[model samples]
Target chain A: MKAIFNKKITFVIIGLLGMVLAVTVSGCKVNEAISSKTGAQLWGENCRRCHNAPDPNTFSPEQWKTVGMHMQTRALITNVERDKIVAFLQQ
Target chain B: MKQYITIITIALLTSTFAKAQTKDTIEVQKIGDKYYVIVDHPKVDTTKQFAPAPAPPPTISKTFDSHFMVVGLATIGFLNTWSVNKVNTPTGVVSTKLPTTNSFGDVAHYEFSPMFLWRHSDNILVEFEPSFSNGSLGVNWADITYFAYPGVILRAGYIVLPFGTYNKRLAAGWICKLPTDPVSITSSPVGSDWGIELEGGQQTGKMKVNYDVALTNGFTLSATDGSIANPDVNAVDNNLGKTVTGRFGWLPALNSGVEIGASGLWGKAGDANTAYKNVSTAMGALDFQWVYAKKPVAINIKAEADMQYVTNASYSNPNPPTVSDTTYTYKNLSYGYYGMFSIRPIVADKFFRNVEFAVRYSSYQSPKGSAFENRQDQISAGVCYWINWRTVFKIGYENLITTNPDNNELAITNLKNTQNILYVQFSVQF
Candidate 1:
């Protein structure tokens, strides 16, 4: 009986992994929205998760570059997101 | 008769001149070793009161708006709480108080912490925070980072470990939702240590993957009795072993609103050449986050679980065992887990839209007979008002329940006395 239970659990885990892989494939086919997000969109989406979105004009171009790096490390943001946000804030 | 009239006129004129001169006159005289002059004049007005203005406010911050500069986040807040509990002792019933969380039950519990970030260049950044709580000065985390590229980063110095979500992403005063930190769940083993880390993220077609790894002078074990000695600060290594810790995250959402993460740490904890030299410790944590935003409302869901296992070893028993057998051993295992849910009405008016409600539940357990033995559960609920983009006013309440089984007797030694607490805090990141 114990062996049967272990086999069932193993099968369930494998099935879940297959589903996750399928979803990944479908999502990529749908759109590259995650990578193509504009700096303004990425800035608002990521900042709003923790606190209110800061004004892009808060820092100068040089300052925003530094802030972009800091936020990437602090918030675990993707490189593309960081670059776009920095570009937007610098503008 | 003519001569007498002339004399009378001259005398009258001379008397008039003398009276006029006496009204305003100067006299010079010598007193002691120096000459002195006196002048008599009509009195001048001298009746005005003196008033002074109050001092200016403290310099809480400075703008690092320049291309290369340093900016700061200043936080100051207070906490208050009370508890009630009834315990039955060996003889009779007793009223007892449990240990307070943070500033709970202490009127003087106050904190003023200043966190700083310096951008040296486009590729180099430095971050550090100083903590001042209840009149003591300490460090939160100080580290420098280098962005090698858009997808890779290299960092060194005393840095926050890539553990659970609490210490890395949300432990800041302005970021936490409640007045008190949730019990039983947090950055496990240790919060941070002197370390070097390498991290990067990449997009594979539709999926985004992020990973971070670190090597540091990790934890130490008690030499006499084999138990974990968490090293949360920068210290010299007691042994030759270096700990390896890291986290990997996956985000499948196009909007970056969902993420699932797994983290782990492992190291040799015993001192070199010690009897417990082979005692190794390992910990792992799983975390999840989801966010929903629409016209009607916004929702946030977060969950995490942490587990630790230490290699078995024998140690001196605390209790007075038989002289011949003074050593004892027990399984060293512990775990903590929590889940949080929060919501806010985004479509409402300005005041209502800024209002958020959050609640969390947590439970944790430790080895049965170890010195760090504990079993605790906690529930915290709170409301937050976003005063601005980075400032907040929060009000929260927490209910803690603890239980230990054995003869159905509540020993109530530790494990945080069971109690209900209320908290209010105002935190700002500026």
Candidate 2:
């Protein structure tokens, strides 16, 4: 009876440690996704010439609405590319 | 009981090993996002151990060209012509022979002049001037201006000071129109005196002001003394002086695009003859300009009234008083005033840019105490054609009327009434 009780206690401790490790590892994965620099690298390769580094304060929300409409003709940026560029600028 | 305990322990150890392996795999995937690094534990910090990616090399743009060249010259001419005919005493007959005695007479002549200018940027400018006439090689005014800024320009060399628009355009040919009341038209045009000048000014809103400060050597005021037979005694040189002139202009929003301005000049005239002291003169002027345009047709108007006051003038003869005894004393105070108007109307708009019809009127008065107190009026109508941006060809007919006061010392009992003049001029610039 004593041996069985010891085995059960050991199993419970092992299970709790497994759960804690999984939670910690999952947290780290989420942090890495948020901090990745892939978007920055893509921007530097594609668009750093005529268009200066994106400045968020240059346009207000209302101004950005108008700017997005004309961005295709002025900057030659497609809709998908414009959206990504805008997101990076906002960030 | 011991066997049951061993089996449970084995199961727990197996489960713990599997969980640890699964957690290590998850941490490896997380580290892969950074730089494909594999980590075996969640608690391990890889930030300091990871090396940053190298920065990319700078790229050069394709459209980069960097080379340019510019080159330019300015020429000015000051011509003075005097044609004097002697008159027989009793019969009052005019002769081309040189007069022996000092007598009041009439002189008429024409002057042709040209100025060439070239400039390369604001750093350097070269000027050449040639004045041609049937009589003698005329005078030339040449200068180079180095602009330090838009407001300040430094000029070195010789120049003819144009105190007014008329002085700038007409006086090069006609000197009798000197706008002083006590007129002295008989000076020399070696008005091409050497000088250094600094002209600077600013324009703000409707007001503009400019100041010209010049230091001169061998400067003369009037060419009236040309009548003196002995060129040695009459001709003067090697004089030193300075002149400060200020011009202020205002453009009011009224009067149909008219611009009005006033200018004042004060300076000391160096005594070319050492026996006499230097004289000081004060001059003032008022000017008005107007512009009118009808689509392709345009007209420009400029009018000016100029006055000069001369004091402390003394006559001196260097040739041991040959002409007159006791040093030829004369009254010092002199004044002159004149009004002039120029009208330019565009005649052709398409091919010829400056082809225009122009008419000008001028009237002058000399003061009583001066040797030349003659009232002269002129009416001129002309056509001007522009060859380029800075060159022009002018042909004109002028009708001149002269009246000397009955009590004037210079005017004879009877003088010629009206004189008609026809002139053609070609001017070029670079």
Candidate 3:
């Protein structure tokens, strides 16, 4: 019974580590996709002159939520564009 | 087999009851014509999420600050030490050595000097100078200076003494260029006593305008008991009298590829006596300097001429009562002009170091009625190695030639005038 309990604990630890690794890898992919799209849009509109394309991974999701408000003043992105950007970053 | 089937049936029933209890609860009751029911379940959606925003950028502002004074003080201290140690030998030696030292040395015997200066702001600066040499006590050289603006500065303190154009040796070069008769007995260290001076100046671009006016209360030339009187001429009582002097100069550009400037000074020495006829003398001089250089390498040329006129000089002897009063005059006295061309080249870039090679020529006619009236000239060549902005080491060789008067009126006849000098100097600003 004690040996069975020890095996259970080892399985739980491995599972937790696997979950963390999966989240980190997915976060990086999502950040890369978001940054590429943002860069393309910014370059197309000549917005790069004033501000560089935002790197999603540079700030956490909570920080990005507030930054989105300030970006709207002159960024002039539609709701659909904003939603797409967020979705890409959160992927 | 029957027992096993019964146990399985019981376990299945128990599990079914537990499942029904854990399921969402709902109640229904039949009324006259309709049915009413109550239900319970988890309330809201659990999938939604939110994130926080980023912080704002920082700001910048402006304010005044102080610079470190330690470095400046250290520099000043080093220069004082260097000047004192370099000139110690000459201050003690009475050798018939050639005037290998600069003209400034001939003018006033300089002892070791330590000077401290502080500039609290752009508008205020003060300085203190004390000198010691030849077993003599330290003396105050200068102490006061005030600035009203970048272009104008006011000074009130012990000013540099001015007597003959050749006086104030510090202002002169390290060595006299002219050869002198070995036999003539001339006064050594020819500066006048200290006095008050007022000076104002303006500088712009490469040009500078300066004016100085000075007055001496009185100074004893020598003590009756043979002591090295203080450079502060007013240290003794009998040597009290007012001296008036003025100097002006204009330099268009100091660091330009080529630079030129001319300076002039006029001064008067009041009576040496109180009741009897006071010895009054007036002296004037003009100097021109030119330099050609490009940053690290340059050549400098300087030339100056001085003249003096004396009046109301008198002497009395107790043996003669009927001899009433008589006056003596010495006029048209002139000191020959000297010129030097110095070549300086940067020797080290790391420390802003340089090496200087200079050749000088000086000639002056002795005062009339003073035993030695003949003229003399000397030539000197020296090299100076600048260790840094505030330190230098110098070595020089000088040759002297004198023209003796046929009348033999002076103390000594023909003499050899030549000497070698090695000196090192360090200066700092604090």
Candidate 4:
């Protein structure tokens, strides 16, 4: 019975894996044109999905410059978009 | 039993402070010939490394980080809730029960932790992470920070003395992968205390170097007989020599995904009543964290090694001076180390990509006459199912081994030799 249970779980996980793949492939398209979005909108759209976004005023402007550079790579954001987001939060 | 109760009580009290004040208040006081202004500053440097990737874009209608970027995080939903529940089953424990629990099928931890951050402005911030577990409350730390500049940050109030990643990151339930933290971490001389600290970081070539220096009230050793002579973390310095602690780390560029750190703390532990007037304690540690990700596979590794020493230590019933004619002084040494590795197969994508496998090994040995004087080893293997980036469910198995002491000083039989247990936990941050 334990073996059968394990097999059932394996099958269920495999089935779910297929669904996730389909969604991910669909999500691979280019992001929507973001020219109209403000820095706050970019920050909201980019930074708030995984964990709660920290207050932008949490660090100095120089600190944000460094943090922005570091996060650009971590968050996989374009340099232009990161600059906009950092500029919005650097107050 | 007394220590257990005391620990639980402290945990409970600490948890209540998680609701930190959000209002920004400025007080100007004339002290003799000088004027002082106390204000809030919300600032933190990337000193500890492991910069959080931007969480997935907010799905909720309200984005806490975005809506209040101008007013500060405190005005929005800065008071976030974190919770964890653990269940354990002990197997092959013949003579004694586990230190965390006695029977199988017992709930090891049911904890609610609240993190409050009040970022008043670009220059000032107040933050606290407090937790309540099984009716016991504890405050991890609470402090008001001032960002004097990009290179200097001054903090006052009860501060979590910087030592390693565990002291800084473990309070957040969603981040720590294990149900319980390593004994080497919690048992060390690291905890929240009344302290003032200056910490900052600077980029040097390819490495970002960060430093933290602090002066705080140190611990004192109890001289009573039949009681634990462990160093008591006091709010006030017992002696004139205040404890000094520092941590320095090097992050080899964010893209490298590696951080290495070393920390040390030293202070006089003697009070007025002790025969040895200048007894002292010192501890040093080395720690590292590294992450490697390539498409389908992501690996995370962390390790730490630390040693502690106490000068002129005495373990005597009632009074140590009475036990010996001369000032009998002994030097006590203790050491501990741990390493952990975790891997996630990202090839599966989305829900499947959230599954992670992890393993950890830890060991500790203390002086022969201290309260926890045994040599212990623990190995844990676990799997985590991430419902999202901020919530997870975990199941694990732990194999614990220890050397039985001549005297059962700790009184728990489960810590005598070898014990095996199954562990499971559910943790989330809202």
Tens digits of per-residue lDDT for model 1, B50-71: 1233356577744343344565
Where model 1 places Cα greater than 4 Å from the true spot, the runs are A1-31, B1-68, B85-111, B223-227, B232-234, B403-416
The weakest ten consecutive residues by lDDT in model 2 chain A span: A69-78
Tens-digit lDDT track for model 1 on A15-89? 534543454344333346565678899887877655567877677776777777777886777677788888888
Name the docking class for model 2: incorrect
Q: Which candidate leads the pack in TM-score?
A: 1
Give the lDDT of residue A6 in candidate 1: 38
Give the fraction of true interface contacts kept by model 3.
0.00
Q: Is candidate 2 or candidate 4 better by TM-score?
A: 4
Candidate 3 lDDT at B264 equals 28
User: Interface Cα RMSD per model, in Å?
Assistant: 6.1, 33.6, 36.5, 17.3
Estimate the TM-score of every prediction: 0.76, 0.48, 0.48, 0.62
Off by over 4 Å in 2: A1-91, B1-121, B166-192, B206-208, B221-241, B249-259, B270-275, B313-355, B384-395, B406-414, B423-430
lDDT of 4 at A44: 60
Better of 1 and 4 by TM-score: 1
Q: Could you tell which candidate, 1 or 2, scores higher by TM-score?
A: 1
Each model's lDDT comes to 0.71, 0.43, 0.40, 0.59
C-alpha DockQ of every model: 0.20, 0.00, 0.01, 0.02
- Give candidate 3's TM-score: 0.48
Worst 10 residues of 3 chain B by lDDT: B76-85
Error of 4 at B198 (Å): 0.8
**Evaluated on chain B only, what is the TM-score of candidate 3?**
0.56
